[model samples]
Target: MASYGGVAVSGGMPRFSDTLINGGVILEPWAGIRAYASYAEGYTVPDVGRIARAVGTAGVDIDDYVNIEPIVSNNREIGVELKRGPLDASAAYFWSTSKNGSLLVQTAIGAPFEIQRQRVEIEGLELNLSVKTPLPGLTLSTGYAHLIGRTDGSANGIDVVDRDLDGANISPDRLNIAASYVQGSLSARIQTQFFLSRQFERTPNAYPALYRFDGYDTTDISLRYQTGFGALSLSAQNIFDSFYIDYYSQTVRPNDNAHYFAGRGRNFTLSWDYRF
Candidate 1:
């Protein structure tokens, strides 16, 4: 080897030093309106317990099953909110970076991969709005999220500086919408979640099959009655029983029938809660 720890001739534990800053501020530009900005630094320890459970061989040190590396990330975000009259809305965008971000990748032998840390970057946007309708006892609410990630392409044996981060860190875009109605101690509502689709075609620069994704949506309806004793709620999920594969099962382990889990079918549930 040329050197140890980037030195001409030496051997010692790696050393690193840096300053961390975390803070945020909010300003109300006008009545019922506010703007905010923030920054934070954080790190998460690896889960040794879970890693140990996955070991099939004896005489293995679970704590040492994989590199006990912590991922340190820095995040910066800015957003604005408006709350006036019967309307409330907010939007925010964030960018994050981590020199030691962990991502999962399948092994060449078609087995689960060990946690590996690499350089990673991510960008995301969020939006939410809710309003009270004039039609008495009716309200509409919606929220949307968009996220994407990038990592050193060398992890995939490519010489490029950065490439798509894959499903381990990036989830397909999605939107959630719901409507509620209330009248005389009775409330009824419905909500739906829409999953965006993604496509990646294998080519000179990238491999697509491993990350291609399909879109799907599910809807649910619920009704509740308020009484002196408590509140009774009757709800149904995936009311239409839409048949589709889950996002992670399809994108993370594509083409693997064993892992192709289907979304839950239509089901009904009754719940009651009492006030103390």
Candidate 2:
């Protein structure tokens, strides 16, 4: 390790210190109905691995490659919530803007990756609902999210190729449904999640083609029992052994032609928790 005046090299382990503020207001104008609005600022630093593996110009020292700016974003949202008897629901719309956004862009299908410095805009809608059945200790819940993201077509005030931001590790649409039951000390729950099709990678300098990921879903179930001494639980994930790919595995690399990594198959787990 190298150092400068008691500071270790590698930019002192790439430290990032940021301050964020978020606030919201909820108004219950009448019984069982409420509305809210929120504003928040988000900040994120680049991954150290992204820096280490970044494709750099020849003759540049590794230490010099670690210097990169962080991404900062501001989010604004407004929503309404309802809680009437056995029904609970909420819906919201949000928009976000980011400057100096970090995106992975490859020159070709199997080429190395480089960061794209640009502005980004993301807008989305979210809806959630949950209802408790008249039946003893049973409830059903469902949720959906739709996202539309895009990037500014300018770099340094010059027009460049603009593209959708739906991919790049983010799916444009998502859905989830779950049902749960509770009686005495026993509880059971089951859930399924769906991911809508999304762009996989931004491939430029090649044929103008659409690169996307197919939609997929997975189901999981769990049961738990509480005892005097401990708790016992059992779980089955991807119950049907659905074949899929990891969300972030579409990056272009030389050895692989941007083939995605497979998702986990069916698996079962059991465990006990002891309380002291």
Candidate 3:
């Protein structure tokens, strides 16, 4: 992949271009198992929309635009899957490194926006399991993932832990379990997702670890029925009414109390579907 763009400045328009390559492979030599491995290289440019909004605003600097650089990354992963009888399982490990990775940084204290560059290293593991019970049309599935990331170099004058790290915004651990049943024209499913606690910066200017959002889980259920005319469906989201803060809301703070965007409470929806 490749991209080209320019920023208007007093001197001239600074232009940039980036290229990326990606590929992967898989092998299945046994009836119940398969193995796979993959590698990829990619890059990203700054968000021009956000930059446009900041232009001419107080405390915003044109140098912010000049400092922006394309972020590049190299990633690799390997994993295996197992399938036997009514049971299936899989696991994988992945590692990635980013060059000039862009992160929210405080150009100065209380700055609303700033982008810093760093070399970042990230690694993680993922797992999944599923089983189909003898019970007619019933299945259970579960999955989990854990990740960790840190700055890769020391030239930026900040310790890996002091950079208001962006990775901290991501929940390091997550789990999801679900059950489904299907018979005739009727189907139903229920699921729950758990998020492990993570650290976050209240503002792009603050140390990334200044605050934390306690982990929380939410549940949802759905049911559907089909008739000669059309299908009817009902869904209950956040069935448990559990509350949580998503990643984005935690990263930026207009005020101390406003840092979190509360998770939605329980809600319901019903709908009809027809095909011509």
Each prediction's Cα lDDT score?
A: 0.77, 0.73, 0.71
Please give the clash total of every predicted structure, in order. Answer: 0, 0, 1
Compared with the true structure, model 2 gives a TM-score of: 0.77
TM-score of each: 0.82, 0.77, 0.77
Residue 238 displacement in candidate 3 (angstroms): 1.8
Cα lDDT of model 3 overall?
A: 0.71
- lDDT string for model 2 (175-243, tens) is 999999999999999999998765532423232233455678999999999999899999999999999
Candidate 1 — worst ten consecutive residues by lDDT sum? 1-10
Q: Considering only N, C-alpha and C atoms within 3 Å, which residue pairs clash in candidate 1?
A: none
Of the candidates shown, which would achieve the greatest lDDT relative to the real structure?
Answer: 1
Better of 1 and 2 by TM-score: 1
Clashes of 2: 0
TM-score of 1: 0.82
lDDT of 3 by residue, 86-184 (tens): 999999999988766755543433445544456667789999999999998999999999887666334656535333345333444799999999999
On TM-score, the candidate that comes out on top is 1
The C-alpha RMSD in Å for every predicted model, in order, reads 6.9, 5.5, 6.1
Pairs that collide in candidate 3 are 164-208
